[model samples]
Target: MKFRVLVAVSTLALTLGIAGTGAAQAQSIAQALAAAYDHAPDLQSALLSAKSSAEDIVRAESAKRPTIGASLGGNYNWAVGPGAVGPGGTNPTGAFTGSSTFSAGLSYNQTIFDNFATEAQIEAARAGAEAAEYQIRNTEQNVLLDVVQAYMDVMTGQQLVALRQENLTFFRAQLQSAEDRLEVGEGTRIDVAQAEARLAQGEAGYRAAISSLEVSQATFQRLVGAAPRNLSGGHDFSRLIPGTLQSAIAEAETGHPAILLAKAGIRAAQAGSDAAQAAFGPNASVSGQVGTSYSTATGTSSGLSGQLGFQITVPIYAGGALGAGVRKANIEQIRSEVDAMGAYDQVRAAVIAAWSGIQSADAQITAAQAAVSAGQEVLEGVIQERDLGTRTTLEVLNAQAELTTAREGLINASSGKVVATFSLLAAIGRLTAADLGLPVEVKTAVPYTQTVEDVWQELRTVAD
Candidate 1:
């Protein structure tokens, strides 16, 4: 019975020894991150949003240009009237008849001045567009962090499944030994029943681990945009983490996307406030029109004319609308400033939390590793003592269970450490595709912004 149990244990041990060595290809963590950076829907949506914001600059600058319009129409008129000649000739009155008149014209209007309100609006729009660019980085960080967590989850789940399989094998060996001892009249029925119960428990645990693994696999596929196969263990990002907490906080203050976005908001709001104040001043514009008409009743040249004019609109009194706008804009500016200050606090808090998580995970990993080693030694001794009849079968089973638990703990702690390391990088604003050196094209908002910033751009239809 002892020999059969040892053979089964040895077989499983050999299987595990060769598990990491095979023809299967190992997918690295960098590959997963790169895939996520290219395919994540949230990141893609943010990119599109930033592109949309770029158009705002174009719309704001449109006020600085001239607007031209053309029109053509032909109208028929009928009338009968007595016409008298001024020369006092006999029967000089004649019947008048109607005729058709055709006309065409071109009109143009240009804003010559607006108290710099348009300029202020353009500045506000530019600031908003810049803020949108930072939003993309913010979204990138979020998606990448999720990918990191999912990657570690899959790794941890895989380890748990393997551990459960090993436990199932060990339990089967215990059951076989119990049955053999019972047949030889060296063990009670209770021992056999206890072993059977342990085997059943092990099977349940194995199934649970398999379910957990499936969940992790689905999450990995969702975030990484592909099925996970032969994935290597999660990477050690400890080197990417800042050396000190103070350094991390400082980095967040200067480089964090959230803080940058808030600062941009403040600038946009200040520009808006300036624009609102300008509303109280006069708006000046130049307009011109030219038209020619052909009428059968008169010579065509008689209906031709051209005119040019300039106008200024001074805000004498509105139902207090302009004043209200100025007040609202000032309030928004204050709110934006407050939000920027709040963002700084939020970034600092996040850095502290992430740093603490890394420290805790490090300690947990060390303690769990040591426990696993000690548990293995204790199990070996307990098994040996059972063979010498100095320990009960239950004691051997307990020792085996303890060792398995310790190993599982170690697996979770190690995975947590990896996740925490990357999280610290995220907190410090260094968790970006470019910072990580991912082999993918990083989309930027500059190209679209530059394209739309032309003050003399002509209207064109955009392709779908």
Candidate 2:
């Protein structure tokens, strides 16, 4: 309960940017994930790439839409020579004549038909966009996993630092006790030297532990977008995992971002192949232009000239280029399908690994807990024996070392359990913000795509 109060106070201070001179904010795993989701530059890059790909849809659709453009120009010309003719009449020898003309025009062009080439291109673009969206999800999962690992590292490091400090303090007291006993002739110099050696080792170990913890804190800050605070070491993401390995593998095979991305790739490649084949089909379009021109020499203006025309292009032969393109696209399509199969296999393997990791961590935690309990009793008994002269200083130190090792193992196994559980969640494609039910708005290309695909706008932008 007191810890809860500290957490509240720390969290409030952190929120207000005045967390200094107090206990660190008890940043929860969920909060860290949310912050990382919001701040991940990797995720942002993916989102941007997805939005850029979404523009392809517009580019493809443009093939079927009418386009209008305007032109304006003014031209001046001069002629000189005996044979040069002027706007008024033939120019005299060595005389120069000039004329100015102004013209303005507008042209409208629309695609009448192109077999199904444009349609295939549009489909391909849409698939590409879909693939990019999957990429964003994949990147999000990766960033969140990184944050989880970093957060856990700092949590584990903090505990290790405290353990090492406690060990250091204990060794210092032991050294003092040995010195006191020696002055009273109750202990030998060897005992005092042994205690001093242990104390020196403890000091070095404690310092090394502090250095490691500081490094972990830096990494945590980099990934979570904030310095590590009083992060809670207790996080169980096993609930997010499927009930069994088979179920988890099935989920990943079907729903993993990599699988989805590969599927989209296949679709896009198929569309590209179709587009390449469509090149053999006929294409038709209609275009029109209207313009007015004035001639200063004639002191006359021509009536607005209008012309309209339609064209149909039927490919006869193209030096084998068209066939080659079709073949290449077909090959790409095949590759995409093969890649999809590979993704399925990879995701299944990852699921298996993560599932095994969770079980291993569980077993380690159990064994380490038992070892820690036994180690404490053994260390206590050895210390008592040493004080009674039945055990030497070295023996007591050895017992202490064993207890410390057990405690460290317990800390590591506990941390590994949480990390392993989260790893399993990530492998099963359930590590997303929505999957975790985080409180941040999910970033997606939907808004940008919807706006860009809607009726054309002269200027449009979407706020990040």
Candidate 3:
């Protein structure tokens, strides 16, 4: 009966994470990752933030455009006595005593030039938006890596639970054998007691393993957006990883989103410095207004009044605020440069560490496989020797316990290998749903940027 159950459990393990197995569809890791990309609120928030950041480009670009406005107003006046003569007026002797006045105008202002200050601001905003877009990629990688780890955790948890159950069954059989031998005068009560102790310990371990599996399943559900079922365990990302640690580090330096974001930050800070320096240069603009108004008391239509003007303003001093801004921007630019350099170093270290983990797991899996085989052989030998009256029931139980531990180690090593390989891929910035060849459309922030940059953006809403 135990063997039949073990066989069924092993079969279930092999089919875990595959679809179309049971009444409920089994979700593959790829499907889980895709679902997470669609459903993760954190990722969704990051994408929305990227969209918001892209609007800054539109706002900055507005400075290059013209602004138009219109206004109207009226006032009434009643004279108590004759008005005195007004200087520089058509009716210099005295103005009309009871005249109502009205005015209306359409005004326009355009920034003809500002020493490229607005241009620098636009460039800075564009760079910042690009950096924000890359940050979405970083968030994508984070969510995908989380899904991978959670999936593997569920797979490994199931394996552990199965191993514990088998160990418990083995100990129960050993206890039965010990009691039988004691009844036949071939063993002492001590042997039965030892077997009972092992059985109790095995039961406790089995219960702990089940609890852990439940926790892992819950975590998997939270991340992948579905309960784990039929999770096939051949999840390996080593193929997507670089062939060597040095190559991995080089890839990370070039492609890591953090490093790219830092580079963009430097460009944005430099543009800010440029804009601040532009404050020292002469500013130029043009304005025009056209209007016509009529007053009821005068009973005359006021002819159109219009004026066009050009202006230039050069800053002589600004209470040191402009200089301070320039200095602050320069400092930030330098800091961004330093941050880019530091980002490269940090990414390189992560790649190295993740690569080392993969290499170590490879060795561990190999050694653990050998250990499990040896343990199985040892258990078989001890069982045979006990049947031949040369070994005690205690020895058989010890051998079986060793075999169970060895098998558990193998299971853990396998899981570690899978997760570490994925970590290495993520460190080098290639662990994406598209990179995995998942059958889902890869979402990108480029569409938002493109729409914002369009010359004729009549509709302001982003496409769904």
Candidate 4:
């Protein structure tokens, strides 16, 4: 009897040893995450967006570079207005004559000075580029968190399906026993009917579990780029979390990518405001051009001309446009500061929420483990009582149902624990490929913007 009870307990409480089976080695969580990292389209899109942002700096730098160009032009005029021609005596209009003129030139212009407006614009662009880097990290955290979610969900779905299958098998046996007892006149038809009802219910539950598992596998394939097979679905993540909730909240508010991005945004807005203010100040520039022109047809002429000029433009009145621009820039600066404040609040809230989820999942797991242990003992006792004619068929069925419910609860809590832990990591901005040490090439903003500051080409694209 003890041996039979032990087997029943093991069936309900044991973790699936997927690796020990004859099947190939089970895929670890890190492997799944690595695959997702390499294949996720969302991550790739974030990288592209960062590259696009890097172009802003290049554009801003262009204002400081020299602008050189060359041009060639030609013109023709007919000589039949007032001059006499020799085609016929004293017939000016009788002869066809024309003068063709051509000109070629090269020009050079540089900012020389712009009252530091270009410098301010360059500073703003650099800040925006830095913000884009943070944005990339933020997107990475979100994608990794999503992968963690999909991984845990698939594991939980498989676990539920296994539990329900075992439960269904138990119900089938109970139904058989009840039928046998009725045939021997030891049980009533009502007992057999109850067993039949439970068997049908268990079958339905098993089918539902199967359907749920299929959906989870589809989601896993979409995220990880492969269908899940022989998943071990276990990891030691408890050590990764902070020792205290307060520490986690502190880390998130100060170090999270969203917070950093918002802070950079504030700097960008300040620089933009500076650039707008500089617009009202006087600016100076030097320009030079050299050209040659030639004409032919009776009055031949040729000459080479060159000129150098220095100009200063002061904005005394710009139809109120300059003041409006300054006002707008100041408002944007204020808005960016507000956004930083809001980012802190959001990050703090996320950390607290995720930490709470972890605590709740831990408590639930502990309780469910104890309940499953007690439930197995109670189920065995109820079965023995029914055999000894001290308990009814309905009592045995109720006990079995309770045990199954406890096992299901245990399964859910176990999976929830892992998911919640990952959520906490994400909240703290540590749920990244580097933190996990997954065997995959970690993509970063550096590669995407390696040469974004090179502004020699007029028509240029970096990393095209």
| Among all candidates shown, the one with the greatest TM-score | 4
- Candidate 1, which segments miss by more than 4 Å at Cα? 1-23, 79-98, 234-237, 296-304, 459-464
lDDT of 2 by residue, 395-462 (tens): 87787788778778877887787887888888889999998999999989988898888755535654
Q: Per-residue alpha-carbon lDDT of model 1 for 309-351, expressed as tens digits?
A: 9999999899999999999999999999999999999889999
Error of 1 at 222 (Å): 1.4
lDDT of 3 by residue, 254-370 (tens): 998898999899999999999999999998999999999988886887899899999999999889999999999899999999998899888888898898888899999899879
Output the better candidate (1/2) by TM-score.
1
Q: Rank the candidates by TM-score, best first.
A: 4, 1, 2, 3
Q: Name model 4 segments beyond 4 Å from true.
A: 1-14, 17-23, 79-93, 236-238, 296-303, 448-450, 455-462
Q: What TM-score number comes out for model 4?
A: 0.91
- Give me candidate 1's TM-score against the actual structure: 0.89
Better of 1 and 4 by lDDT: 1
Over 337-433, each residue of candidate 4 has an lDDT whose tens digit, in order, gives 9999998988888888888887898899899879878987888888888888999889988987887788788778877878888888888888888
Q: Which window of 10 residues has the lowest lDDT sum in candidate 4?
A: 14-23
Task: Please report how far candidate 4 places residue 183 from its true position, in Å.
Answer: 0.7
> Which residue segments of model 2 deviate by more than 4 Å?
1-24, 78-97, 458-464
Indicate the TM-score of model 2. Answer: 0.89
Q: Report the poorest 10 consecutive residues by lDDT, candidate 2.
A: 13-22
The CA-based lDDT of model 4 is what? 0.82
Worst-scoring 10-residue span by lDDT in model 1: 14-23
Per-candidate local distance difference test: 0.84, 0.84, 0.81, 0.82
In model 4, the clashing pairs are none
| TM-score of candidate 3 versus the correct structure, residues matched by position | 0.88
